[model samples]
Target: MKLKGSMWSCIGLATLLMAGCDKSPPISTAEEQPSAPKKQVAFQPDWVPKALGSGNFEVCLSNEAEENGVKDLILPVGMMFDSWGHMTGSLRDSKAFDGEGTSGFGKSDQYALALTARVHLTSDRPCAITQAQAVTHQGFRYRHETVPASLHYNFSAGGLYLNKKGGITNDMKGPAGDAAQIGLLSGTPISDVGDVYRATEDL
Candidate 1:
């Protein structure tokens, strides 16, 4: 009887030890763990002509804050009616402003697109800055082309000349091939001309 009692006691202890070993550490509850909030990236402007549909847009802060700056500029400015707009750079693919709708706008119309870039906005909501918008109920078709752009003040020259102060824009990379030397400037989310894109649908 004494031996049996001792055996039972040992078995109980072993069972308890095994049970404890089998048990898992307390599992974390969802409440115990929290997740970080995501950044805001959605905002559509009414200015994008209804015809071309919508565009792939990211928060300006996304591109603006980048080390190299915007790779491609989604321009808010558009042609007259049904202006889908351009996404790359330079407004005029051609040097001849007389293409059709190019002149009247200006001769400098051939300058870099970044110099005259604009973005879209519903209202000047606290979220984003508003520029220009489409006034013409009818929008126009537009095209885009990437061109070499030199944007900066002459490190030594400064202005148009070395002594002058104001200057144009440029990418971090040195200008190569054919490029336009344009000043750095921004346009309204909406443009007066929508800065009528420098191309025409007539041809």
Candidate 2:
């Protein structure tokens, strides 16, 4: 993929979500005291990766199921953000295959899920993703794995991935074409997938 002329860098935040318990007693003063003004953080708009121009791309799914079983392939094609800081995306049903044991007859179905956004960068600023994670929303649990460097974006912190088992793997892989190809070809069982959600100093 050809990177744009703009220079990008990655900033690793120790925490994405902040939570705390108020242990101190509540103030009971009749007179209200002035409070300090809160700092206003600048808002930055998310940008579509150069590879996915206009934020449109086709999610390819190859039938890799054996000749005697049923298999399904799911992938993310669009991305969006919720009212909260959390990022979300739509899923695409790429292909489904039903193998015949002895009738020599089988069925193969192919489809695509059009998405307005498929990748969610944590920040608009340039940053390289040091980790990736596979977050399952449904179906059987699969092995987690780290994303390849080819897909890492200096501007985007992470992305989304849909597994065959009907689960979304968040920040688990880069959006690069080659990285997607590797995921499809590796045939790595979900049980043996490694964890790539943690930070990696090396790109």
Candidate 3:
């Protein structure tokens, strides 16, 4: 699919979630990137090249479970802090980040929760994320596997929703949406998914 805006393919989530200020160069999409043969795909998370989840690499594997199967990508982010280093509670409460969401109504959210996403790959079944897309509160589609020069790639919530009638507050948190075309692979497919991805590069 043809996409606009900054795009990061293969392996770049760790850099996207990094806590620094240096700007990264703009990332372009793999519109012309050749897809790997299904037989030739390699499914490797960050540990092989470096220590697991070290530096700026995120291993994209989640625990297969009896519950919480609504999403394949889930993580608990630390509460946001403002410029003065004051705690920003949750996205909705932080008026500094007021925006609209799926609801299309402008209301401050009462609660927000960044669920814990442990930093290890529990299941290595390289998934073919058949259909995935993410956007911002103001409705900007993004494909960021790594952090952009803007410093954050907080996507408007796709799969997950807020607990409140006025929840989630329309702030950005990344989540590669549905694995619509899912199938198990012994190795990684040239991952064509996320808000994410690089052109089949090392993590």
Using TM-score as the measure, which candidate wins?
A: 2
Reference-based TM-score of each model: 0.17, 0.21, 0.18
Write down the lDDT of every candidate, Cα atoms only: 0.24, 0.23, 0.23
Runs of candidate 1 exceeding 4 Å displacement: 1-45, 48-107, 110-127, 130-164, 172-203
**In candidate 2, how many Å is residue 34 off?**
15
On residues 1-203, what C-alpha lDDT tens digit does candidate 1 reach at each position?
Answer: 01212343688899999888888776787678576643322223332222211222111212121232323333222211111112222211111112222211223322222222244322121123332222211112123232211111010000111011222211222211011112111121222222322432222
The superposed Cα distance between candidate 1 and the true structure at residue 100, in angstroms, equals 7.0
Off by over 4 Å in 3: 1-61, 64-203
| Model 3: per-residue Cα lDDT over 105-178, one tens digit each | 22222111122223222234222222231111222121233222122111222223222332233243343323
Q: Which candidate do you rate higher for TM-score, 2 or 3? A: 2
Query: Between candidates 1 and 2, which one is better according to lDDT?
Result: 1
Deviation in Å, model 1, residue 169 alpha carbon: 3.3
Sorted on lDDT, best first, the list reads 1, 3, 2
Candidate 2 runs further than 4 Å off: 1-23, 29-158, 175-203
- Sort by TM-score, best first: 2, 3, 1
